[model samples]
Target: MKSLVALAVGALVAGGIAFAAPASAGCQAGWTPWGGGEICDGPVGSDGNFERCQTTGVLGFGGTQCFIANVGNAQPPRVGP
Candidate 1:
């Protein structure tokens, strides 16, 4: 019984660490800051589960632009049942 309790506690600690936010190393390499978000030449790194916002749009005459933002501890979107 004692061993089982220890195992449960250990699992919880490990899980919490795994889901913790990554240290902000600023935007990923090659990604630049823009309007409080990031703009990358391509897809941003998945190191911190970074996601591109769904609101892609043009910035005046600067052509198309997209933004990437961290999703913190929020659950990922569900897929097909």
Candidate 2:
């Protein structure tokens, strides 16, 4: 019975540690502070394009939005056409 109580206490301690772990924004690098939020570059996509992400709200209580754009689709400036 003593062993059972010890095991339960240990489990609770481990669970508390896991629960207290801080969450990450998953930004590879280049984190910039913005108005009440932050913006950063996200991981590359399967299409070989990069993703731009913005996170808002306090302590991640709000949400994060990601936008993906294809660099190949953009046309260079007309060069004084």
In TM-score terms, which candidate is top?
2
lDDT of model 1, residue 77: 28
For residues 14-56, write the lDDT of model 2, one tens digit per residue: 3432333223443321212311343454455577565655444
Looking at model 1, residue 28 earns an lDDT score of 21
Q: List candidate 1 stretches off by more than 4 Å.
A: 22-81
TM-score of predicted model 2?
0.30
Put down candidate 1 lDDT per residue, 1-81, tens digits, no spaces.
656544544444334334434223322211112211222322335564444322111221122344444445423321111
The window of 10 residues in a row where model 1 has the poorest summed lDDT is 28-37
